[model samples]
Target: MKRFVVRLLINSVALWLTTLIVAGVSVESYDADDTLATVLTYLLVGLIFGVVNAVIGNFIRIVAFPIYLLTLGLIALVVNALLLLLVAWISELIGFGLSVDGFWWGVLGAIVLGLLSWLIGVLLRPIMGRSR
Candidate 1:
């Protein structure tokens, strides 16, 4: 439970950072004037992203194993980008969530988001006492 919360927060931070660094990827606050609403929206979107990646993303990765081998893992970038786009689509359907400008932007945002999440996770692992 604690580990799950930690990962969620890490993902939220990564998504927030991506918004700052990636111009084409951004989250829309449910309440435009409310700071708390904006933060919570990011966290919620992060949660959606985690769930989407864990479920659909895993299935797709498993099915695309051959492509992964053929591309020497470079296909991971495309996979991640597609996952991000999926998250954005899901969020949009639900009313408030991420908005990706286009395919290439999604790719770049996914790359940065992955790096940020990985770095943050590594930094937090010591304090979090490792994941089970």
Candidate 2:
């Protein structure tokens, strides 16, 4: 779907920005110096992240709704960080993907990634259309 593709692109851009800004959060591609390879790697990782978040994340959110409310939604940061780590582990199994230094790094990286993705999505919404 168009919306899914747009979201994937936004996630790729967000992940790219996170790697640039967060030293501890880096992505390694098949060819480190190849820009196209790096971009595709990011896109592929982003897709994996999205899928993992959509499935596992939704389940966690539903089960942990009470904690989420008690924390005033701050728990989402932790959840997102865990999701990032999950993605990292999954990517590692396949080789050539994201590498997060630690839990704190994953937390910081997830925060920045979420912000960047939101900002990019907001900016592109007009062009991409409100329905999406």
Candidate 3:
């Protein structure tokens, strides 16, 4: 499925931007003073993020849809927060060392992440030069 794979890659890029925006943490390191390693590390982190988001995010969103609708979509924010928390949990499990500060941090992170995703999608849709 080319479409699914494309979406998966986009998700990875989005997650990378999220970490860049929220944590200011480095993703990978190769040497004592190698920025390239850090870049690749982020790419790896992005892949992990995409997997966790794809599998876990789907379940969470489905279960929360009614709450989202009832709150006139306000609950979508909470849902996104929990999803980020879940990604942190998965990262820890996989030895990636990511953790949300708390529920409030997660909420703020989710909001920022959503905005970043929107901006990336808007700009990338033109750059990738794909018409769909």
Candidate 4:
């Protein structure tokens, strides 16, 4: 439970940072004037992303194993980008969350988000009592 919350927070922060660094990827706050609502919006988007990556992302990786091998794992970038786009679509259906401009933007955003998440995880490894 604690670990899950920590990961979710890490993802939320990484997502916020990604939006700042990527112009084409952004999240919409439920209430523009309410800071709490905005934070909740990010958290919700992060949760949705986590769930999508855990479920659909894993399925894609398994089914595309042959393609991944053939492409020397390069296809992972496209897979991750597609997963991000899926998250954006799901959030859109909810009416206020992540909005990705296009596939290229989704790719860039996924790259940024992944790097940020990795860095944060590494930095917090000691506190989390996990080793790489």
Candidate 5:
């Protein structure tokens, strides 16, 4: 659907920005000089990230609800970071995608990606129409 495509694009852009701002988090393209390949790489990573977060991320959140409550939701940062690392791992299997240096880098990258995604969503809300 249009909404899904829009979200994918938003996440791709956010990931690109995150890589630019975070030294430890980066994306590898099939060909550095090929803009289309680079763009597809980002989009592919974004899709993987979205899928991983939707499936594994939700399951973890549900199972860790008690811990989340105990930690006043602070555990979410760690969980998100782990999810980001999971994406990196999955991408690694494909030989070219997201590359996170370590846990701290994953945490920082997740924070940056989340913020950028939120900001982009807010800015595009009017154009995209109000959510139900």
Candidate 6:
């Protein structure tokens, strides 16, 4: 449970960073007007993101093993992008103010957002953890 919360917090930071970098985005983000609500929304969205990624991402990586092999693992990046796009779709359905513009955008946005999250996570590792 503690690890899950940490993961959600990391994902929330990633999601928040996504808004800063991506335009024409609609995430499950609340308006900046309400600081508390926005923070809570980030946590909620992060929770959803973490859970979805855990459940679906593992299956996707497994089922697409052939693609991964064929592309020499480049397909893994696409899979990551698709996952973020899926998150965006789910967010829209749930009334989050987040949306991915298109496939290419999704790809780029996911790459950037993912890299940012990874960087932040790495930096936080000293304080939070060294390994999963």
The TM-scores, one per candidate, come to 0.96, 0.96, 0.71, 0.96, 0.97, 0.86
Query: Which has the better TM-score: candidate 3, or candidate 5?
Result: 5
Clashes (N, CA, C under 3 Å) per candidate: 0, 0, 1, 0, 0, 6
Q: Lowest-scoring 10 consecutive residues by lDDT in candidate 6?
A: 24-33
Structural RMSD, model 4: 1.1
lDDT of 5 by residue, 1-132 (tens): 777888899999999999999999999998999999999999999999999998999999999999999999999999999999999999999999999999999999999999999999999887677974
For residues 1-132, write the lDDT of model 1, one tens digit per residue: 888899999999999999999999999998989999999999999999999999999999999999999999999999999999999999999999899999999999999999999999989998678535
Q: In candidate 5, residue 100 scores what lDDT?
A: 97
Tens digit of lDDT per residue, candidate 3, span 42-93?
5555566667667877787788778878899888788778877776676666
Evaluation by TM-score, superior candidate among 3 and 4: 4
Over 4 Å off in model 1, which ranges? Answer: none
**Residues 1-132 of candidate 2: C-alpha lDDT, one tens digit per residue:** 888999999999999999999999999998999999988999999999999989999999999999999999999999999999999999999889999999999999999999999999999997678873
Clashing residue pairs found in predicted model 4: none
lDDT of 1 at 114: 97
By lDDT, the best candidate is 5
What's the distance in Å from true for residue 56, model 2?
1.0
Model 6, span 24-121: residue lDDT tens: 44454467678887888878777767777889999998898898899999987788788877877777787764578888888777787778879878
Model 6, C-alpha of 21: deviation from truth (Å):
1.4
Q: List candidate 4 segments past 4 Å from native.
A: none
lDDT of 3: 0.66
- Which 10-residue window of candidate 3 scores lowest in summed lDDT? 23-32
